[model samples]
Target chain A: MNLKKPLTAETISLDLKGDSKDAILAEMVDLLVASGHIRDREAVLKAVLEREKRMSTGMQNGIAIPHGKTDSVDCLVAALGIKRGGVDFGALDGQPSNIFVMTVSPDSRTGPHIQFLAEISRPLNDAAVRAKLLAATSPDEVLHLLIG
Target chain B: MSGPAELHPLVQFVFQLGVLIVLTRVGGYWLRRWFRLPGVLGELIVGMLIGPYALGRFAWPGLGHLFGLAPGGGAVTPELHAVATFASIVLLFLSGLETDLSAFLRYSVVGTVVGIGGVVFSFYLGAGCAIWFGLASGWLDPTALFLGAIATATSVGISARILSERRKMASPEGVTILAAAVFDDVLGIIVLAIVVGMVRAAGDGQGIAWADILLIAGKAFGFWIGATAIGLLLARRFSRILKYFQSPEAIAALALGCALLLAGLSEMVGLAMIIGAYIMGLSLSRTDLVQVIQKEVEGLHNVLVPVFFATMGMMVDFGAVQAVLKVGVVYSLLAVASKVLGCGLPALFCGFNRHGAVRVGVGMLPRGEVALIVAGIGLTSGAIGQDVFGIAILMTLVTTLLGPMLLAGSFENPASGLRKPEDAAKTESKEIVLSFPSPDMADFMRARIVRAFRQEEFYVYRLAPDTPTYHIRKDEMFFTLECEGDTVVLRVTAQYEALARLVVVEEMLALRSMLHMAQENVNIETMEHELVAGLFSDDGEDGP
Candidate 1:
C-alpha cells in the first residue's frame, strides 16, 4: 500500500528527453535499470511494450501508468518520468501525456503491483498534485510530491 | 427385368438413397412450412408414398422398382437400412449430449415421480392392449414387452416446441413437463434395454423365468447406470485428451468414434447399442466440449436423422396396418389416455392443479421418434411382427399430431397452472440491470465485463449463436448475462448477489482507468485541425 517503497528518488526522472511514447517508455525503463532494480533490461522493456500494445497506458490529466509483469524483476520496481512539454502516448482523451508512472513486477507475483498502481493513481488524480509534480525540478522533490 | 442384366445391388442402393434424400427433404420442408407440423411427419408420409406398397411397387423399363423392397422381402435395401440404423445411433448420441444435467437435477423430485408414473402406466396399458387384441400371449410376451417399451418414450422436443411457442417455458407446468420428459427418455431407454436383454435371452432358447427376468433387467439397468457414472467422472479427462487433437472436426469425429465403440461394447454386454452411445454422450455432456461437438456434428445430424425417420416409414406395411386397424385405434387412444393420467396425476401431487396436470399429461403424449426407433428395433430383431410395427407407427402418428393441439388448448385458459400461484414468484431469479447511454456503449461494457470474468477464470461461452446471451460458470457459481439494446442484464441467485456486485465494481474501476488514459492521451493537433477546418469552411464565410 506504500508508494515510497517502490517510487524512490533514484528512480525519478525530473526532465524526460524522450519526445515520443516509445522513447519516453525507454527513458523510464533506463532509470529503473540505472537504479539496479531490473536484472534484464530487454526482458522488462519487452514486457512493458507488449502490455502497451494491448492498450495505451496514457491516462487523463497529463498522467500515464505503463505497467508490465516480467520475471526479470524479483519484486515490483517502478520509475517516474515527467515530460514537461508532453508526448503523444495515445491518451484516451486525445491529449498529450506529461507524466508517466511505469511499474515492472515479477510475473509470479500480483498484489504489490496492483497496490502500487492504485496508490500512484490516487495522487495523480488530483490536478494540483499533478501540476506541482510536473513543475518540480529535482528528483527528490518529485519523489516527495508523489509519495507524500 | 432384362434391362441392364439386373443392375448391381450397390448401384441400385446408391440410386435409392439419392432419391430418398431428395424427396424427404422436399417433403419435410413442405410439411413444415405448409402445415406448421413437424418435418418428421412429412418425411414419414413421403417414405410411405414412395415405399413398395405404393409408387415403389411399379417397375420402370430400365430401373425396375427403383424404390422397391430388397430381394429378401426387406422394406428397404440393406445398405440403406444400415445407414438408417447408424442414423439412430447418432440421434441417441446427440440426444444424450444435449441432456440438461442441471435442469434434470433441479426438477428431479417431481420429474422423477412423474416420469415413473408415465412409464408404468403407459407400459401396462400398451402391453394390455397388445395382449387383449391377441397380438401377444401374456405380459412376458416379447411383442407385449416391445409394445410397452415403445409406449414409455415421450419426445421432449415436441412438448418443448409447444411450450416455447406459447412462451410458457418458465411456467411450473412447462418446467415440470420438460423435466419429466428427460426422465421419460432415460427410463424409456432403460425399459428398452431390459426388453432387449429378455428378448435376446429368449432367442437363445432359455426358458424365461421370473429370476431370469430380474437378472436381465438388473444387468441392463446396471450397465447404463455404471457406464453413465463412470463416464461422467472421466468426461473432463476425456475432453482434455480430445483437446490434443487440436481440430474441432477431429474432436467431433473422434467423439463419434468413441460413441460407436461404446455402442458395440454395449451389444457385447447384451444391451442395446444406443444405450452405450447415450452413455458416451451423457458422459461428455457436462464438459466444455458439448457446444463445440454439437456445432461440429450438426451437419452429420441433419443429413442422417431424417433418413432414419423415413426408413421407419418405409417399413410400415399398410396391409398389416389395415388388418389390425381396430387394434391400432384402440391402442392409440390408450396411449394418449395413459400419458395424460399417468403423467398428469403425478403433477397434481407435485404442485400443479388439474389444469396444470392436463398440460403436463398432454405434453407427454407424443411418443415421436423414440417410439418409432424402438419399434424399428423390435421389427428388425423379429421380436415383433410387421403388424405390431405398423400399429406402433399408427400410435406415434396419432399422438404426435394430437400432442401439440391438446398442449396448445390446455394453455388457452390463461390461468396460472401452479396450485398456489405464489410458488411461481418464489423461483424468479434476481436480475441486475446496467443501463448505458447507447446500445454501442452497452455492447462495449458487456464485452469488457465478459473479458473480466474470463480473466477471473470463469468459463464463459455464448448460450446460442443468434442471441446476445452468455452463460458463465466456475466451480459452483453460475450466472447468465444478457444484453438487450442499451441495457445489460445479469441474472443470479440471491447467494451470488454479493459476488456479482464485486465483479461489476471491479469492471467499472477498470473502465474508469481506461477512460482516464483516453482523456490524458488526447492529441492536441487533431483537435486544432478539426477546429480550424470548421472555422474556415465555405458555410462560415456567409456567417462572417
Candidate 2:
C-alpha cells in the first residue's frame, strides 16, 4: 500500500487563450493522444466528458483533474498541463486554474485510486506542496517531493 | 476544552457522533412510525428527549452517559452551530439545484397566483385566530395578530416529499404546488421578518402603531432587495475567477468564500443565511460551470446537513410536548383549520373552484422545518410562553402528520374529489416556449435573435404578451413566435399584440431600426415556430 510510485516529471501546458472549457479540454486530450497512451481519441474523449456529468474532480489550488475510469487500461495513466494565465474551471473558489492532472485506471482498482488520491491530494491542500510540485522540472524530482 | 482527553479527540468526537446518530435514528424512526411525520420530526423529539432540556435536565445517569447527553450551555458550541449553518446552506442550495427552473417557469403564472393568494389568506386566518384566541388568553390584539401571521407558511421539503410519494411532482398541478411552495417560502420568510420587526419594536417598549408595522414591512422588502443586489454583483465577479483556476482546491475555496460572504451579509441584515445562500445559488444558476460547482458543493451537505436537521430536533422539548399532549392535540387541530380556511378561501375565489380550493388548502397544509425554526427563535427569545411554545410545536406536529394522510386519502379514489392532477409527473407532451408578453421583452429577444444569426429567411410576426381572459383568474405573459427562413409570425394577446406591432412599425420606420439594419443576406424575421427558433440558437445569444 505504501509502494513509492515513480513520479515522471510532467509539463502541464496551460493555454489561457481560450475562453471555453471544451477548448481547454481538447488541448489536454491532444497531449494525451500525442503521448501514445490513449487509443481512439474521440472515444476516450467522450468517456471522460461523460464521467464529468457524474462529478467534477477539480480541487483547490488552480487545478482540474477531469478523470473517468475505463477498462481499457491495466496500468495507471495521467496527463498533466498548465494553463498559462488560467481559465475558469468552475471552481468553488472562483479562481482561474492552469494545472491539470487527469488519472485513468481500470474500473476494478478503486482501492489504489482512492489511496493515491488521498495521498497526492493531501499536498494539493497546502500551497507549499503545490509550489514544489509545479516547479519540479524532472519526474524524479516530482516523485521525491510527492513521496518523501 | 474540559472534556476527557485520555482518548484522541477524533475518537471522542466519533463516539459522540456515533451516539447521536444512533439515538437520532431510533427516535426519528419510531416517531416517524407513530407520528407519521418527517423523520426530522422524530429526530427532534428524540433530541429533545436526550438534550439539555429533557434527559440531561433530569440527569438519567446511565442512559445519559450512554447517549452522550450534557447539561445546558455545556454540550453544543458555537463551532457546531457554524457547521450547522454551513450545512443548512448546502442543503438549501441543493434544494434549489433540484428545482427545475425551466419546468417551473412554464407554470410560473399558476404558481405565483396560488403562492401569493394562499399565503395572504392563510396569514390573515392565522392572525384572526391569534386575535380571537389570543384575546381570550389575555394577550393584546397586535401581538396575537403577529403570532398568527407567523403561521401562514408551508415548508417546501415536506410538501415535496408528499408530492414525490404520490408521484404528482411532474404533473401540472404538482408543478404548480411545488412552485407555489417555493414562492410561499420566500414570501413567508419576508413576513417573518416583518413580524420580527414588530416584536422588536414592542420589546423596546415602544408603542405598537400601524405606522410602525408599515415601516417594518417596508424595511423587510427593501432589505431583501438590498442584500440581493450586493450579493449578485459579488457572485458574478467571483464566478469570473473560476475561469482563471480550474483546480479543485481553488474552486472549492472560491465557493466556500462566496457562500461565507453572502451568508455573513444576510445575517448582518438580519435575514437567514439560507436566504443569502439561495440568492447566491440563483445568481450562479445560469453559468456553464454550474454542474461543476454542484459536484463540489455536494460534499458539504453529506456531513453538515444531517447535523442541521439534527440540531433542529435537538431544539425540541419532547418531554414538555408529552406532558401537554392534550393541549398539543387541540392546538394542532386549530393550526390546521386556520391554515386551510385561511388559504383555501382565497384560492377558491382566485379561480380554483371547489377542488382548486381544496387543493390549495391541502398544498398549504404541510408544516415544514419553518415552523420548527419559528418555535426555536421564539423559545430562544423567551418572549413566548410555555403554552405558546407548546402550541407552536403542536402546530408543527399536527400539520406534519395531517397533510400527507389527507392528501393521499383524498386522492386515493380518483373520484374522491381532489383537483389533484392525476400523478405528479402526469403531463401530456406539450412543448411551449414561454416569453413574457410585452413589446419591451419581445423587441429585446427579437434583437438578440437577429444579431446571433443573419439568416435571410427570417420573419417575426407581432404577438403581444399573453393576457388570459378576465374571468380566468390568471396573470402572466404568454406569446407564440414563429420563425420561417425570412418571415416570422407571432401570436400574442390582441391588445399587447397591437402595441407590439405598432412598436415594430415605429422601429421599422426609423433608419436605425432593425428593419433598416436588416442586411439583404440576413433574414431578420420572427418565425411562427418558437420551438424551432429555440433549438438552433445559442442560449441567451439568440433571443426570441
Candidate 3:
C-alpha cells in the first residue's frame, strides 16, 4: 500500500486559502471531489465533520489529520493542504496547525485506511520533511516531498 | 394537680420507631465493625434485647412500657408491622432485580435439580422436626408446613458475598450455588404459596386429601408460572415505558408503584405479597434499566430493610424460645444437614466431585430474608405460635453464622472441584492494562472507553459508587473495567480479549484527536486566570 497511490498531485494544495479549521476541511473535500475521488461530497464532509466533533484531528507539531470512513468513496482517497499562516485547529500543544491531511475511506474496509494513516504519519514526524513540505510552492513538490 | 397525661397511640408508636431505628443502626454498625458479621444479625439481636420481654418491660417515668406488646399478642404494634411488611416487599423486589437471569438459565438443569432436592429434603426434615417434637399434629399441619416453607430458601446474597470474597465466584461450585440459590428463591415462594393456601383451607374446615394437596400445589405453581411468563414477555416494553418518565427517581418511584400494585394483587389472590414483588422484579431483571432503578431505590432499601430484620427480632419471645431451646437446637442441626445433603447430592451427579458437592451444599446453608419473611407471615397470620417462630429464628441464626465459616474452610484444600480437572483452567480471567501519562488522562480515556462499549449496546454501570470500577455486559460476554490513578485495567476471558482491545484502541484514537482539539481551542491565559480565581475565592471558607 503505497501512500502516493491515494494522495496524488491533483488532490494536493500548496497554499490553502481557508482561514479556519472547518474552512480548510471543506476546501480539502472540494479538492477530493474535483479530482473525481469522492462520489458524494456532502456525505464525506458530514463524516469528517462528525469525526471532528467527537475529537479534533489537529495533532501536535503543526500537523492535522482529519479523516473519516464513509461509503461515499469507493476506495481510500486523500487530500493534502498547506496553510503557511497556521490556523488554530485545536492542536494539543495549544499551537496553530499548518499541514492538513484528510482521507476518506470506504466504510466496509479498515485495513488499507489504517495502513495509509500509519504510512502518512511516519514522514510527518520528521521535522525536516515537514519543513520542506511547508516550504514547497507547487502541488507536485508537496506530493513528492510527502511520498518520498 | 393531675397525673401525667396519657400519650396518644400514634405518638407512642412514632417514638418507638425512632428509638428502634437508632438502636438498630448503632447495633448493626458495631457488630459489622467488630465481629465481621452481617449487619442483619446485629439488628435482630438488638431488637430482641430491647423487645417487650426484655428491657422494654421496664416502665419509664413519663412513658409506660417502651415496647409494650400490642393489644394483640405480637410484640410490634399494627403500624410498625405494616411498615415491616412493606420493607419485606422491597427486599423481595430488590432480590428479584438482582437475579442474574442468564446465569440462572445457563446452569438451569443442575441448579433446578439441586434446588428441588434442597426444598424436598428441607421440607421433609423441617416438617418432621415439628411433628416429632409435638409442635404440630401432623405432616400437613399449619405449623409444620410453615416450618418446611421457611427452610427452603438459601440467601443468595450471603453465599455470593462469601464466594466473591474467596475469589471463587467463577468456579463450578460457586456458579452452581448461585444458580441453585435462584431456584431456591423461586421454589420457596411457590412453597409459601402452597402452605398459605393449605392453611387457609384448613381454617375453613375443609377436609385435606392427596388430591386437594395436588390441586393447591397446581394452583400455586400455575399462578407463579403465568405471572412470570407475562412479566418477562412485557419487560422490554415496560422498560421503554419507564424511560418515558426520564428522571431516574421518577422512573424508580413509578416502578415501585407497580411492584406495590402487583404485591397487593398477589395478596388478594391468596399468595404472599412478596411473591408478586419478586415476579415483578424478576421480569425487569433482564432490562438495562435495572442498574438505574437499583441505584435510585438503594437509599430507601437501606433504611427499610434493617427495620424489617429488627422487627423480626423484636417479635421473638425469649420465654417461648427458652421453653423450646432443645427443640430449636435439634431443628437447626437438621436444617443444616438437610441443605448439605439435598443441595450437595444433586451437585455430585452434575460434574462436581465430592469436594465440589460439599462446597455447594455448605454455600447454600444460609437461610436469610426469605425464611424470616415466611416465618413473619406465619406469626402474623396466627398460623404459628411464638415457639415455632422462635425455633425458625434459631435455625436462621445458626445456619447464617455457620455457612460462611464452613464455606471458607472448605476451600482451604485448594483442589479442583470439577470432575474434569482441565475445566478448572477455563475459570482464569485474562487481564489487559492500559496506562496513561497522568491520572486525568486515564480518567478521560476510561470514560470514553465505557462510552464506546455503551454505544455498542453493552449494559455498562459502575460496580459501586465509591469505587472507580464498572461492569460491562452484553448477552453472555461480561467484562470488568477498573480505573485507578494513571492506569486502567480490563479483565475478561480469552474469547473476548480481541473485542476488548479493539474497543480500547478505538477509544485511544478518539482521545488522541480530542487532545489535539483541546490544544487548539483552549486559551491558556484565560484558563489559568479562571483556575486561579476559582481556587482563591472567598466562598471557599464553607467548603470541605
Candidate 4:
C-alpha cells in the first residue's frame, strides 16, 4: 500500500552471486534475517525453496523473481537485486535472468503476494526502467532507479 | 444461505477463479523460478500446497467434504473444474491440431517402427522394474505393471514443445522421435484397452480372450471409424455452415458447443475425452476452421490450462510423498535411462549415428502431464496401490521436471548444418508424379532451371518432355516434390542435359497403410497434403 517507502542502502543491497539460484535466495534470506525484518530465516528459505520446487518463476526476460510467504516474516519484505551477467533461473525461454525481486509476506494475505508481483512485473513492463536497473552503478543507484 | 439473486453466479465464479488464477500465477512463477522446474509442474505443486492438504484456502465446500477436508476450506472448487476441463480439451486438441502431420507422413516407416519399439521395450522394462522391486520388497501385483505401462507413454505434447525449441524437430532424428511417439501413442491406447479389459475381467466374469481383446479393439476402432467418417462428412458440412457464422461470437459459441458435445460423446464410449477432442480437431483441421478454431481455443485456454495444471498440483501431495520418495527417485531415474538406452540404441541400429541416437533419446525424455493422468488411472483402478502409482508420479515428476535442461543440452552444438545433399537425400526424399506409377519422371524434369531457389523449394524439378521417342538423357538426376490441392513440382535437369533426359520411374509404393484409416477417411483437397519429391536417375537415376 505504501509505494513511497524509503529504502536504505542496506535494504537495497541484496545478496546475488553465482549461477546457482539458491545461493542468491540464501543470501537474500540471510540479509532479511540479519536486518530483523524476518524471524526463522530457515523457515522463510524453506518456503521459498518449496515454492520453487513447485515451479520456476524465471520470467524468461533476463529476469527471475523468486518469492515466498511464511509466518516467519511479519510485514511484507522485498529484496531487490541485480545480476548483470545473469544467473540460470531455468527459464523456459532459455535466457538467463539478471533481475530478482525476492518477496516474502505473512503466511496468509494473498494481497502482498499480488502486490509484490505487480511491483516487479510493472517495472519490467517498462524498457527504460529495465535499462536503468541494468545500467545502475550500485544498489543505491538501483534503488534510485526503482523509486525514480 | 442467501437467495441466488443476492450473489450473482458470475461474481462468485470470478471471485473463486480469481484466487486460483492469482495464486497459480504467483505460486507457479515463484516456484518455477526458484526450483528450476516447469511452469505446469509448479502450478500443480502450488495447487497442492494451498489446497486443503497443506495450508488452506477457499474450498468447494461440496468436494472438500468428499476429500475428507473439514468443511469450507481447500483449493478444490467446481468453477475451476469447468475451465480446467475446457482447457484440457483445447490443450489436447491443439496438440492434435498443431501436430506436424507432414513429418509423420514422410518418416512414417522408420518412425513407426522405432516408436513401437520404444513403447514396447519401455513398458516391459518398467513392468520388470516394478516386479523386481515388488519381489525384492514383498510382493508384486498387476497394478504395478499397469502403472509401468502407463509410464511408457511419451507425452507427445511435452516432447514436441521441447523438440520445437531445440530446432531439431524437422530433422530426421526429431521427426523419428515424433513419429515413434505417435506410434507409441497408438500402442499405448491399445495397451490401455487391454489393461482396462483385464481389470474389467477381474471385476466381473468377462473372460480375457483374443476374441474379446479383438472385440474391444474392434469396438474402439469401429467407434472411431464411425465417428471419423461421420465427423469428416459433417466437418465438410460444418465448413459449409461455418460460412454462415461470420461474427466471432457466433463461431465461438458454435465451436464450444461442438467441442463440448464431442467431449461428452467420447466419454460415453470409454475413450479418453482428449482422443475425441483430437479427432474433432483433426476433422476441423481439413477446413479453414482450424485457424479460427485454433485462435479461439487458445484464447479460451489462456484462461483454462493454467487452472487445469494448477488443479493437478492441488491434487498432488508432494509433502506427504516421503514414504514413496525412495521409489520415486529410483523409478524417475530408470524412466530417464530407459528412454535413453531403449530408444537411443535402436536409433543407432537404424543407421543413425551416435549424435542422432542421443538426439532421439533426449527428445523422448520429457513425459508431460499425461503421465500423471496414467498414474491417476492406475491409482483409481486399485491396480497399482497408492504407493506404486505414487512412484509412477515420481517418474513423471523427473521427466517433466528436467524439460528445460534436457532441451538446452540437446541444442548444444547441433549437427553441422544438416546432412549434405547426397547424405540428406538418403534419409528421406520427396517426389511428386503425374502418371500413376509413372516411369522416367524425366518429362516432369526441366533443364536449365531458374535461379533464386527458396529453401522450402530447395529441390527444384522442371517438368520436361521425356518418353520413348523423346528419350531424354538417362544419366541426368532430379528431385521432385508434390502436394495435393497444393503443388510444388519442380523438375530440374542434371548438369548434363543429355543425362537429364532419362528418368527411371519406380512403381508407386504404398506405405504400411492401415486399411481402416483409409476406408473411413475422406479425401480432402489440401495443398499441404501434396507429396513433394526428388528424382535421381539410378545409373545416374535410381528407380525400383
When 2 and 3 are scored with DockQ, the better candidate is 3
- What does candidate 1's lDDT look like per residue over B367-388, in tens digits? 8878988899899998999899
Report the C-alpha lDDT of model 4 over B208-273, residue by residue, as the tens digit: 454455666676677666776687688778877876979766775686677668867876676556
* Model 2 Cα lDDT, one tens digit per residue, A29-136: 666564555656676667577655444545567877665556565455555666666778776577877676665555554324433343454556568877876676
**Superposition error at B40 for model 2 (Å):** 2.1
DockQ of each: 0.03, 0.01, 0.03, 0.00
- Candidate 2 per-residue lDDT, tens place, B437-514, comes to 455544554554332111211122121112111100112223333343333333333223322342233233332344
Clashing pairs in 3: A90-B520, A91-B520
TM-score of 3: 0.72
Ranking of models by lDDT: 3, 1, 4, 2
List ranges where model 1 is wrong by over 4 Å: A1-148, B1-5, B60-62, B106-108, B204-207, B427-544
Number of the predicted model whose lDDT against the real structure is largest: 3
Best model number under TM-score: 3
Decoy 4 TM-score against native: 0.53
TM-score, candidate 1, first chain? 0.95
TM-score of chain B of each: 0.82, 0.65, 0.87, 0.65
Q: What is the lDDT of residue B122 in candidate 3?
A: 96
